[model samples]
Target: MTTDPREAGPRPPFPGEQQQERPGLTSKMTPAPDHGETSYVGKGLLTDRVALITGGDSGIGRAVSIAYAREGADVAISYLDAEQSDAEETARWVEQAGRRALLLPGDLRDEDHCRALVARTVAELGRIDILVNNAAAQTINDGLDDVTAHDLEGAFRANVFAMYYLAQAAVPHMRPGSAIVNSTSQQAKVADSTMLIYAATKGAIASLTIGLSNLLAPKGIRVNCVAPGPIWTPIQPIAKTPEQIEQLGADTPLGRAGQPAELAPAYVLLASREGSYMSGALVPVTGGTPMY
Candidate 1:
């Protein structure tokens, strides 16, 4: 079966009034984003491995959880307590994939909580072979004046600082050949003013991934990042206006928003043995959008 890439998934202008408050839910999405529920077919690429994915409750995190589980890795997910329902749903998918799933709910803004997520994953899942730093906090702003100090701190804490917090605690426990994959964004280079703070943090993550890869390379641990283009996930409705939601991913070269399922294979490649020589790499899965 052959399908055209541009029309492989849903295209815009999307239907209905898609809008929600912070920390949105998949159930609220009109067509509902696909997390590889019936699409991804694992080939035991990560068998016997254990993975810890932050923000694994939904969106890209959820999709990765399902893919990793099917690839034969036990999965642990970290999420804010408010998203427990979504988190449980993700756990279900992992379990259905015939792998273990651990749910850790807490705010990643706290360094202690970030460290604890790694600790608990190691304790319950046996060991962490892949750490996916996919959780993030994004807020749309009008301009510099609309951004506040607290807003900046919140974004950095959850998006950048927490990656360090978890890495610091997990690396020692991880063995050689382990990998750390992060989620940056196309906006990191494309530079969107409306999402200024969010884009800034994503840029910082890309830098950190490179520097961290160098620091961990000698230990035989690889680090990489994925810069996503416009993807359909709960994060869109939560952070964007209803108007923006309707036109989501309409500007992409592919002519449609990438789904969370579309982003999973990239995470899998970076975290699996197939990507052994891929450290410090920034893999772009932006629906043909360019990233420099």
Candidate 2:
């Protein structure tokens, strides 16, 4: 039986009535998200590769971990300390895919930790073939008055600084044909007033991707990015109020929020050999949200 992509799963609960501590757990979500546990089938597209993904404990990161494992890559997942439980779940899925799974728990906001993350992944997994900078943090702000110096600095530290730290550390170990996929957001292009800081960081990430691609091309390394739209993830409960969550993705042309599972294939494609010739590109998985 064939299924329409738009009608594949029940629309997520409007307003996600339940909320969890920041970096929420999948086990606590009202309707559990689909991470392609039973749906995605891999044909060894990334056989024998090693991947290091930040924020791999949940949301789009978890989905990417599962996809990479299924595609024959060992996964090293790094997440916040509070997300150990969620990280373990992601590791479980990766191991179930008949690949090695390493769980690194720490805050990526620290430059030292970011360096250590890369070192550990290389030490444990042998080498890093795919580096995914996916972890990010943001606070809701109504306007410039609501934004604090602490909030501004914190967002950049977590979102952009860590990416640079990880890249610097990982690049030395990365050989030709390696890929780096940074996670940007649709907000990078279509700025949201309330998400000013977060949007700015994403824009920085996009610029970094392009510039890095140019700088790394001579070394045969590819740098690219994925700009996701409103995807149902743990961040929603913490970032959006119940009322706002209720109307999530309503303005998107697709008329619904995307699931983490829906965003994994794009990462997989970009990381695989198929994307060897593709670099300095922004692949939008924004559910019809135009990047322009």
Best-matching candidate per TM-score:
1
TM-score of 1: 0.98
For model 2, residues 1-292, the per-residue Cα lDDT tens digits are 1367566654544745766678777787756777888888887999999999999999999999999999999999999888999999999999999999999999888999999999999999999999999999967788689988998999999999999999999999999999999999998999898899999999999999999999999999999999999988888878888777777777777777888998999999899988888999999988788989
Q: Which ten residues in a row have the lowest lDDT in candidate 1?
A: 1-10
| Candidates' RMSD to native | 0.9, 1.2
Which segments of candidate 1 are over 4 A away from where they belong?
Answer: none
TM of each candidate vs. truth: 0.98, 0.97
Structure candidate 2, residue pairs in collision: none
Root mean square deviation (Cα) for candidate 2: 1.2
Task: Report the Cα lDDT for residue 202, model 1.
Answer: 96
Output the number of the lDDT-best candidate: 1
Q: lDDT per residue, candidate 1, 86-115, as tens digits?
A: 999999999999999999999999999999
